[model samples]
Target chain A: MTKSKLSQQLAVDNLKIGSHVYSSRLIVGTGKYPSEDIASKAINSSGAELVTLAIKRFSQQDAISNILEVIGEKKLLPNTAGTLNAKEALRSAQLSRELFKTNLIKLEIITSSENLDPNMPETIKAAEMMVKDNFEVYVYCDRDLNNCLKLEDLGCVAIMPLGSSIGSGRGFDDLDDLILLRNKIEQILIVDAGIGVPSEAARVMELGYDAVLVNSAIAYANEPILMASAFKNGVKSGRKTFLAGRMSRSKSSIASSPTQFLK
Target chain B: MSRIKIQLNGTVEQIESANLEIILNTFAPKDRPFAVEINGEIVPSAKFSDYSIQENDKIEIISAVGGG
Candidate 1:
């Protein structure tokens, strides 16, 4: 192959988030699957380098879950799923550090359960604390450009803007706002939450997003294995398209065949 | 011994116990991986036997569940 083609392939092969570099850009979450076996199959098939799990009380009554053992070699990202404020989120983070033994924390602080939108004030406060602790934090936030910029300045590794509310299955129609945020931020951008299908994930990647974190959509699907494969392909196809660039569209007739002779 | 009330993972329990280890023995199964926090301070495993539990001291035994 040509030198340019080989070099371009190598460049897209590695996705860097903070100090963590991964070959696969898609990050899967270990939630909402019918069972652990199904979750394991889905995760393994998804080809995701990093997987997210909510850190909760470790009770003996609860079935023991060795997710680290299940998804072998994949980075275990512990998130503050149920935290409503900064203090709670920080406590969860500190505790998770002891358990997971990783500095990476996905800061998820939500106030309203109805829409499950992230609390900006709480998220910002928690991000500051995580930074001070030298934790490589990924901020789960809204698509607001200003909030993303603020997080980027505070040494966050990646800025994860929700496609919509968490677990809504609602697709992001406000592509303009997302575009604005994407253009404004220099940090690695990941569209987390509200992805209903593989197409949604593909659309986000086609818009130049670095990665996506999918859970409910795939996990809750009737056929998670097939869905996972679709997502893996979707992410790869979208990334390739983004690198390949697109042809301009026109309202008037633009013939693809024998246009030179006709014109 | 006069018992003290502490919230363990958000559950209120009246225990005759005086230390974190006694509390763990009361609630958690003997063989399990876990962590403890007393009023938001995570007490290391070694300190569980020595750290005395006082009245109304929010001692939380965080139990991890499988979730994403």
Candidate 2:
């Protein structure tokens, strides 16, 4: 039997987000895992084409070797975590580029520790510098439509708007803002951080977000593999629903039985 | 012979070595980057040349990986 036209269209149109091409627009993080093995399994199950990692001190006693080995040829995205200024972010991005051997950098500049709120000014500045330095910048910013547009103007390949505070597990609080940002920004719109459950991810994708990046939720789950699978399904379902398009909502329900047809 | 034990890829192993760099050179060549953990603390890559290993010392090495 021939497939539906919607499915055929979706199959033909490839979703392009920045430099990365994804059949499934879900990005996962590699942190807070019970074990490296579980993290690897979870990531593979999630079907994420891109992943995030922080550049920090690598210890002699560290157990990340097996994890690295497991990752093999997958894309490694190094983030500039805890950088409060543009200079620090730039330096971190540069170092990560050398260390991870990838041009993709998740530009994160924090202003306060309470909420891990990103400093928009610094983030924009750092993004500009990284772009000029020939790096693909994914700026993690608050759910501010204006700021998102500004970041897009700064030449960021992707604008990662937070669903909530980083690692808060609160999920998407500003759905309106995210929707507006999605409508305004031409670049890739990714919801990064604060996604507590698969529903949150589904909600973002349903709202037409290009992708979602999650870390703590999967990493800290009781069963990382199960949670990862959940996320993977949620993202796929959401993207499918969005592309399928929904019927227009009306306050009054349309009766299935037509009054004019009644004898 | 003094037996120096360190965690290799998260597994404990013992070797006989007097110099730290020699042992590391024997295991991980300088060309590659690996995070070395001694006991529970991580030894910075920059200090690998200077850091010495003693008998029964636990070491762990982790490398940057790509996934997800």
Candidate 3:
């Protein structure tokens, strides 16, 4: 009935990344699912338009489940996971482009196995190479402002600043830095990693991130299907609330009821 | 069989025919999507049939694995 409600209902702006635009802002991962059936149902429920995959080696005799069949129309984001250097990451990117038939790459060269944080220097070099090679790089770098700016300058389509380390489920607590980065950079801003719950995903989206990439939170859940649905709602709610425009916070508490009445 | 040895995904194997296609057919289904590298060089799918594998070559076949 109100203008606010009307806008909330119509908060369906298409998310643009590079030359491509998508309707769903929640991007899910195709990893860690206990089974293909669960993976299929979870992603189907999540309302995700894209999913990330790690390119790995499987002997032809090994019968690993085909991820493409489960994703079903969702765009695939093949990442350079498990690679520790720019050279290896480059090769993985090339292979991913060939296999996924998409230019999009989540360029990640982790510094270590303990925490899958992007090694800044390696990531930057790989991003530069990938961009030059005509691949749309969605870089997974730290939330450092200058670093993000450099990545944008390198012609990456999107910059993913971690909420925390990958798969840690640490969530984005001190999101002020990310907010600052988002304000300064003109490129697509997506929160990737360290998100452990639906509320965390919603919070990041509410903070004005273009999208969020989620995996462990859902895939490792006791009930992945239910968690996936929760994430769908979370992203929707957060996007809606963001578009509706949240009321400015006050330094002091503002009473909704009559404080003078003392009831 | 006049076999030569090549390393496939970290395992050494003996093969009579030293071709990428033959090795690939032994491990992967033709219908699936995958990429191949011989001694760290990407061998385009178009050239799989012609690319010859040599003794002690490191062959890597990377396919789609789920991840975020």
Candidate 4:
């Protein structure tokens, strides 16, 4: 009989944002699924405690089942995905709070339609208003360190930097800045968007990111449920590796075998 | 029955009554969770029954959809 050292070494680690605590560091989005059944199954397999949903117009004559019915008891983090400016984002946030009855919001104010880049000024404006309105805002910004620092100063509960352009799946576009940003920011940092595989999730976690929000990689996969499970394991492994404290990188390779062995 | 015209979700619609709750119930199930706004102000669910809908009011009924 053997005991796993990794399990023994790690304590109970939970991701906390504002007053809410989540057990899973992987946050899943409920978008671009083939069906609600598949989305539900995939989300279940991922073991995500927090899920992101976007608020949109409710059609009058639509007979389709509501997405909320499948979400059940999982905590909802509503995002203002389509808003272009501060006013629209604020209204969307208010409506989301009223509908979901939660103050947790993912503030996204996209500036360009072609690239879908976030409007930094508009996002900051919306974030400040949301915070003043007593909402726990989680901002989605670019990798620019100065903008991220400004966002943190505005009282957001979490800062989500795009892994690449949204849904581009190019992995991390700027790894160096990501590492530096990790050292600077003290709030909960979750790398959101543009992550295509489990290994990338692992890589982000290995860099000591608190969490990762993935949607397209899992939702659009050939087998979403299986992919979801893979990401869950990836996140866990990365977190454990981070906790273990990785060996320092050396310019020259040191031989593993002892040089003076059996002399 | 007299009808009043108001904008519902960006479209002009004629309704039989001016009650907010009745209009909401007619379009959506009571069990479904959603939020209603009239001319840019959010109306709480509890107030739906007590609130009155005005003519030409731009009403937007919103709910959660899949997103990341």
Which candidate leads the pack in DockQ? 4
lDDT of 2 by residue, B3-56 (tens): 767666555678787465666766653444555556656565677778778766
DockQ each candidate and list the results. Answer: 0.48, 0.11, 0.74, 0.83
lDDT of 3 by residue, A1-263 (tens): 48876766576578989988888889999998989999999999999988898888875555657877777878888899998999999999988887778899999889988768889998999998999899999999899999999999999999999999888888985689888987898889999998999898888788788899999999999999999999999998888777767899899999898988656
Interface RMSD, in order shown: 2.4, 6.4, 1.3, 1.2
Q: Against the true structure, what is each candidate's TM-score? A: 0.89, 0.78, 0.92, 0.94
Task: Flag clash pairs in model 3.
Answer: A60-B27, A60-B28, A61-B27
State the DockQ, from 0 to 1, for candidate 1. 0.48
lDDT of 2 by residue, A51-79 (tens): 78776544444533545555545677888
The number of the candidate with the highest lDDT is 4
Residue B55 in model 1: shift from native, Å? 3.8
* Total clashes for model 1: 6
Off by over 4 Å in 3: A1-12, A252-263
The reply for model 4, stretches above 4 Å from the true place, is A1-9, A60-62, A259-262
Ranking by DockQ: 4, 3, 1, 2
Q: Of 2 and 3, which scores higher on TM-score?
A: 3
- Give the alpha-carbon lDDT of every model: 0.82, 0.77, 0.87, 0.88
Could you tell me the lDDT of residue A177 within candidate 1? 79
Top of the candidates by TM-score: 4
All candidates: CA RMSD (Å): 2.9, 7.2, 2.8, 2.8
DockQ computed for model 3 against the true two-chain complex using alpha carbons: 0.74
Would candidate 4 be rated incorrect, acceptable, medium or high by CAPRI criteria? high
